[model samples]
Target: MQVLTAVPQVLSYVVALVDEVPEAKDVKAGWLAFAIFIGLILAVAFLGFSLVKQLRKAEAAEEAGLYDPSDKKPTPMPTVEPDRKDDTAQNGA
Candidate 1:
């Protein structure tokens, strides 16, 4: 009857609407973003590990008396000779 015919028409219209939607064609960009994110994470992890190792090495060195403690008198800074003539005379007021 008319009701059965209308049901098929409605179903076809719904199917057409579903088919009209565009499929995802740029999946590679998503993968590239994921790869970059993972690389950043690994880089940060590597830096953290390096920092810990260096800190441990420094602690060990301190324990071995390789460096003097700051509680003691500081070492004098070495004096450096000027490499160039003073520029004050060149700048006329």
Candidate 2:
């Protein structure tokens, strides 16, 4: 487990080594930047999804508890339009 923790440090050192070589410096920086950008995007997306899921779970728990539903207003579900060529026809146009 301790060895696993040192992987990032080892990888960083390898990148640093490549960066020291004039011919490989640009490649090193580009790869490093790409990896960081992808990691950031994934982190943000995961965090946002986790937060929404937690909120939903909390709401469900509240609904199942000894609390009056009328006391707290529930969030409305958004209306989604049907994806039909003739919307009226689908709904008896």
Candidate 3:
């Protein structure tokens, strides 16, 4: 099949259609991008600080016996014991 035959022609046509393409040097992360980056950094820093503060508070609460910590798992429910008599009778039958 000549399925891929038009690929090269299409690529060449696309290249020809393009009048100009800026050099790599012309591309830049402008002030808007820099501002957004700075904003993200500040947001992360704020969240980190807030997280630390919350963790400290949680530690204090745990020390004061307000609530149990996640590391300490809750006591599991006791498993039900099967009737030994029924099991023995069934086996005998």
Candidate 4:
């Protein structure tokens, strides 16, 4: 029938239109993903450079006698306690 043929043609046109005009959400999502990937790569490179610089500084300090290994001593970490209110009136005990 002519109706069936017209339906297929309409569907094809719709498909073509949809393919031509992309949605804003899809474009935004792709840009966000690209930005995140680039940011992650930059952060990793910065961290690696920072680590290398710190290592070099430490080595230079050691060579200059800034740190003495023979006189090194271990120190204990301090502990902190949280303060709580004593509810003696509520318990009545």
Candidate 5:
């Protein structure tokens, strides 16, 4: 009986305490954070889809022989001729 009587008093105190607390004022900040999170998710999804599309295009191009690594040979750099007058002076000609 005493416990039951004390329970109501505790409940009333809790209700009073809750009523005295102030409501949140930064609700807009919470909404902004959620918007930013959703935007980042959308951006990442778009980037992933684009990357896959580019990879598929590249694969198709490779299969069509548009990019043949084995047939590509590196061109040699051109050699520069020395000046004839400079060479003659060095040789004491």
Candidate 6:
């Protein structure tokens, strides 16, 4: 397309304009950004350590029989005995 072809010329003109401009001020990231960056790194490291610890704990719990296996048959639920009910009250004694 013609637009794509004109992009290089426009970019060259922009580069020339930028080259003519003088540096006004020097900008720095400063200490606050550096502190926040370090804090984030420490947080991520802490989270990674916590994740590994919890995973180890879960594995230990599983080994100690906390988690039941799927292949084994489940225990039957307790049934209510019909004989234990008050028959007279049900019959409007």
Residues 1-93, candidate 2: write the lDDT tens digits.
Answer: 999999999999999988765565455457889899999999999999999999999888887885676888779999998866877877895
Q: TM-score of predicted model 6?
A: 0.52
lDDT string for model 6 (1-77, tens) is 99999999999999998887645566657899999999999999999999999999998987888887874478999
Of 2 and 3, the candidate ahead on TM-score is: 3
The local distance difference test score of model 3 is 0.88
Query: What digit string (tens of lDDT, one per residue) describes model 4 on residues 1-93?
Result: 999879989999999988877677766557889999999999999999999999999989988899887866668789888886678966886
Candidate 1: tens digits of C-alpha lDDT, residues 1-93: 999889989999999988876568833457889999999999999999999999999889988888867755778999998788568866853
lDDT of 3 by residue, 1-93 (tens): 486998999898898889677799998879999999999999999999999999999888888988856767789999998756666687896
For model 4 the TM-score comes to: 0.45
Ranking 3 against 5 by TM-score, winner: 3
User: Which tens-of-lDDT digit does each residue in 1-93 have in candidate 5?
Assistant: 899999999999999988875567733457889899999999999999999999999988878889977976788999999756667788898
TM-scores, in order shown? 0.45, 0.41, 0.54, 0.45, 0.45, 0.52
Model 6 lDDT, residue 77, Cα: 100
Q: In candidate 3, residue 74 scores what lDDT? A: 85
Error of 6 at 90 (Å): 92
Residue ranges of candidate 5 with Cα displaced over 4 Å: 1-29, 71-93
lDDT agreement with native, every candidate:
0.86, 0.86, 0.88, 0.87, 0.87, 0.88
Give stretches of model 4 more than 4 Å off.
Answer: 1-29, 71-93
- The segments of candidate 2 whose C-alpha lies over 4 angstroms from its true place after superposition are 1-29, 66-93
Q: Is candidate 1 or candidate 3 better by lDDT?
A: 3
